[model samples]
Target: MTNPYKSYLSIGEKLDKSKFILATFHLQSENQPPARNASASDAGGFDQTAGGVAAESSVGTWTDVSLQEKILWENLRGRVVELDEKASIIRIAYPLELFEPGNIPQFLSSIAGNVFGLSEVSALRLMDIELPEVYVRSFPGPFLGIDGIRKITGISDRPFLGSIIKPKLGLSAQEHIAASMEVYDSGIDLVKDDENLTSQTFNNFYTRVDEGTKRMKEAGYLKEGRQKIYAYNITASYEEMLKRAEYVVDRGGNCLMMDVLTAGFASVCGIRNRNFGKIIHAHRAMHAAFTRSKQYGISMLVIAKLARLAGVDSLHTGLLPAVFTRDTCLTW
Candidate 1:
C-alpha cells in the first residue's frame, strides 16, 4: 500500500546504494530564457542570464559542485518531496545508479518533459549531478502550422508577403494610416507597427489603431476583398495590454500582436490562453540575443512551441529565402 517511489527507495536502501540522480528545472521566467554562446573552456557554461545558456558543472561528492541538490538527493531518496506552484520551479531525484555512466544525456532527454514535474533548474541540476550529453532539442513543431498560415493568408502557393510601417521616427496617426492603405493595396497581407513605434508622441496608440485599422479595412474593401490586418502591438503591463486588446476588439480589429520577448511569457500566454479571436502575431525583436548562438543557447523552436502553446495565432518565424534575410528555415 506504499507509494511506488517509496518502494523504489526501499529497494535502493536494502542494496546500500549511495548515489541517486536528481533532475531539477528552474522556471524563473514565464518565457524561455534567450540563448547565449559560452566557450566550452569555462566551467560555468554561460553565466545563466535571462536569455542565456545555463552553466554546466559536476556537483555532489565534489564539494565544489556547481549544483548541490543532486548530492542531497543521493542521500535523501524517497525521503525528499517537491512542489512547483507557479513561475518558480521543481526538482526530482533518482538513484544515480539508475542511469548508465555514458547515458546521462539520454536519461535527461527521456525525462526532461516529466522530470517528476519539477523546475527547469531541477532538470538541469539532475544533469549536473550526473552529466548528460545536453540534448536540449524541444518537441516536434506545430500541427496545423505553416500550411495553416498559408491557407489563412490565401498564399499557400507562396510565402506570406508582409511589411512593417517603417519610418520608426515621427509620423502622425494619419500618416501611418496612409502607409497601411498603401501596404494593403500593394498586396501585402500583414502590416505591423515598428516595435519601437508603440502608442507614442504624435502617433498615439489609440489614434493609430482606430485610424490605421480603418484605413486597412477600407483598402481591403476597395482592393481584392482581402483585409490586410494591422496587428496593433499590445505590449505593456498585463492590465494595460488587456485594455488595449479589448479596445482593439471594440474597434473591429481582428488581429493582435505582442512583442512576446518584451511582454514576457505570462503576458503572451495570458492573452493567448484567453482564446481571443484575434490572430496573435509574435514579434521577435529581442530574440537575437538568445537564438544567435550556434553553440550554447536554446533554439528558436523552443520559443515557437511555447508561443503556440500560449495560443499565438501566428508568429514571425524568421525571414525566408524568398526574402532579403537569410533563410533561417524556421516554422513555415
Candidate 2:
C-alpha cells in the first residue's frame, strides 16, 4: 500500500538550516484505517500526522491543490526533518518565504495556528521556534534593557528588591498609597499594582496617579542613593492605556505595568513606541490557561522572547521557590 502523503516526509535529510524557520512540536496522532495492527508500534499513523502538520501549516490541504500544478514546492512548504515517536516529538521547517517579514502575529499564525485544530493529531504542543537573524533583527528590541534600568533606578550593585502588594485588589487609592509607604520602610525598592487592578470607582486611575505620585515623590529619599519605583497598572483598551500612560508620565511616574497576555503584544510595542520614558513592567496573568499544558498551546519562552522584542523592562516570571529565604546566602 502506498502512503498518499509520503512525499511530504523528509526524515534524515541534510539541508540548510538558514533557509527555513524551524519549530518542534510534541505530537500524538490518531491511527486510521487498514494499517491498524494493535501489536505494532503505530509508526505509520505518526508519519501521516507529521506530513499533515507540515502541509497544513505551509502550502498543502486535504487533497492536492491546483496551486501545486503551477507552483514549485521548493519555494514554499514546510518540511518535516526529524521525528521521535517514542518521545512524541517532531520537527518541521517552513521556508522563510512562507512567513512575512517583521510580523510576529503572522509568524505565529502560520506556525502555531490552524495545525492545532486538525483531527489527524489528537495532541500537539509548540515547543520552540528557531528564527533566522534577519527575522530576529526586524522587530525593535528592549527599550530599557538591564543597563538602562540600572542607570535610571541607581541599583547597579545588585538586582532590584520588590514585592507584589498583598490583597491583589480591593484597595482604595489611599490604602494603596499607605501600602506603598509601608513596603518602602521595609527597604523594598519597587511596588507594583495587582494584575487585575484598573480604574475601579473606588481606586480611579486619575486619583491613584495624582495621590500616589505625590507620595512616591515625597518618599524619594527612601535611601541615600535610590528612589522608590511604583509600577502602576495600565492594562486597558489601547487608547485608554495611552492616556493613562501619558498621565503617569505627566505626573512624573517612573514605571508602568501591563498584563502582556491579556492586552496583547501590540500594546507592549505601542508603549515602547511612544517612548514615554517609564519602565515597562509586564505581567503574564492568565498564562496558565494555555502555557501550563505540555501537550498543548504556546511556550512561555516564546512569550518572553516576544515581550523582550516588544520592549519590556521587567517581567514577572513566577514566585521564588520555597527553598530560598532571607537567610539564604548569595554568590552573584
TM-score of each: 0.56, 0.87
Query: lDDT per residue, candidate 2, 264-299, as tens digits?
Result: 887778878898866899888876665767778777
Residue 101 displacement in candidate 1 (angstroms): 31
lDDT of 1 by residue, 170-216 (tens): 88999987877777778777787777777778888899888876665
List per-prediction Cα lDDT, in the order shown: 0.52, 0.78
Please provide the root mean square deviation of candidate 1 (C-alpha atoms, Å).
13.3
Mark the 10 consecutive residues where model 2 has the least summed lDDT: 323-332
Q: After superposition, how far is residue 160 of candidate 1 from its true place, in Å?
A: 1.7
Off by over 4 Å in 1: 1-156, 221-225, 320-332
Candidate 2: residue 217 Cα off by (Å): 1.3
Best-fitting candidate, scored by lDDT: 2
Q: List runs of model 2 lying over 4 Å from the truth.
A: 1-4, 32-44, 69-71, 221-225, 321-332
